[model samples]
Target: MAVGALAGALALAGCGGGNDAGTSAGGAGAAAGGAGSTGAVAVKNVDGVGMALVDSAGKTLYFTDQDTAGSIKCTAACLGFWFPASGNGVAGGAVAGLSTVHRPDNGQDQLTFEGKPLYTFKLDTGPGQHEGQNAQDSFGGTTFTWHAATTSAAAPTTTEAPPANTGGGYGY
Candidate 1:
């Protein structure tokens, strides 16, 4: 997909991936593609995290230090606050290292970047929020260090909260 098109897709899908699972559809990050779809995965600068992978609604996607490669480690209680980002996991444009994995819990495809399972934080009510970054928590016998998924190695500089739009939209 073109750069602008990817951003638009990310915007539509951005807010859709919240606690609500509205409707099911097909696409990367779009197991459900209505108002609550995960939409598409895209690279964008999120507040406090710099250039990183975000969901359709601009919510920062993260990886847990406790997770095994290609396998999910968070379950039950942990899942309540951290939601798996459902997607086909193919992000176009300058974004690379995109992939997907099947979740045994729900039979849905979860998005992964650079081989780490990606998730969104429930406290982040909107896009571009990185409320889960560097958070330390334990669930299901695992201790997790949540970190934002980034495409760069430069030190991230926190910025003002992202603008409301941030390019995410609904539907496909």
Candidate 2:
């Protein structure tokens, strides 16, 4: 009887692992406050690197750091602005070289790139709204900037000289 009960409990747990409430066990569905769902977002090659963004079911309100390498320095008051996405606490599926790591300060798993930590901006509100891209801010004379993904294909360069200006020049 004891063994039978244990098997039933395990089955129940596995069945609950796909809904919003079951997300704690690696389920799907979004969280409150317009955050992303625990479901794995489809990753595609954006330029040369692998990238994933919030889907239609999920709101892109949080932001992650694109420059930090394997270390999440955001915590305490920082979490209030940029909340981390939860659920099985891992970035699931095959996303090229993307992976997850634990934030020692909060015990939350964070997505990493080449072992470096990544983050989202607190101000982003939706998908395709990449206002945080290439953004630069200065703190104590140190400049922090978002990194842009590079394309794997080579772009064409202009080789011809520019035509002469047709408009009149203005001078003081």
Candidate 3:
């Protein structure tokens, strides 16, 4: 099937040395961020999806079914296509429920939404692209179903807004 082939190719690409970007986990939830990460997240009204969390570049954010409250399943070959979304802000996107999770694979904090790890589709050219929504793929023996992150959480009580956009699709 085409999906299988694409997954295979992506997995192979993962073995080609390094990624297009140096993916890093900054932080998750209220947890503090680690070194080599600067997370800046915001909510944007995308075309296909209503309001979704976006990176500094305004690229729509996604979450995987494989990632749980305490587990980060997208690793190794998976990182090629699903660039991790890392940020230090506990309050995500003008709303509460934003946090970080420490990734055992890489020893960094990964940003999460209401406990689910967040990611951005590498294939998406730019902001407003929801190509990753409902997408099915596999890498490194792990199957993943991705969906756009929804901005449905209640607003945070604090007045501090998320950090200003710094202009990188994947957390830089």
Instruction: Give stretches of model 2 more than 4 Å off.
Output: 1-37, 44-70, 85-93, 138-143, 148-172
The residue-level lDDT of candidate 1 at 85 comes to 78
At residue 66, candidate 1 shows an lDDT of 76
Q: What TM-score, over all chains together, does every model reach?
A: 0.65, 0.45, 0.66
Q: By descending lDDT, how would the candidates be arranged?
A: 3, 1, 2
Q: In model 3, what lDDT does residue 22 have?
A: 43
Per-prediction CA RMSD (Å)? 14.4, 17.2, 14.1
lDDT of 1 by residue, 22-44 (tens): 32222222323222227788888
What is the Cα root-mean-square deviation between model 1 and the actual structure? 14.4
Q: How much is 77 displaced in model 3, in angstroms?
A: 0.3
Model 1: CA > 4 A from native = 1-37, 89-94, 153-155, 158-172
Q: Tens-digit lDDT track for model 3 on 2-121?
A: 445655665566555233244442322112121222358887677656777887767778898888968788875466567777776532435567788888877867788889988777
Q: For each candidate in the order shown, give its overall lDDT on alpha carbons.
A: 0.65, 0.40, 0.67
State residue 86's C-alpha deviation in candidate 3, in Å. Answer: 1.3
Q: What TM-score quantifies how close candidate 1 is to the native fold?
A: 0.65
- Angstrom error at residue 9, model 1: 34
Q: List the lowest-lDDT window of 10 residues for candidate 1.
A: 27-36
What C-alpha lDDT does candidate 2 achieve relative to the native structure? 0.40
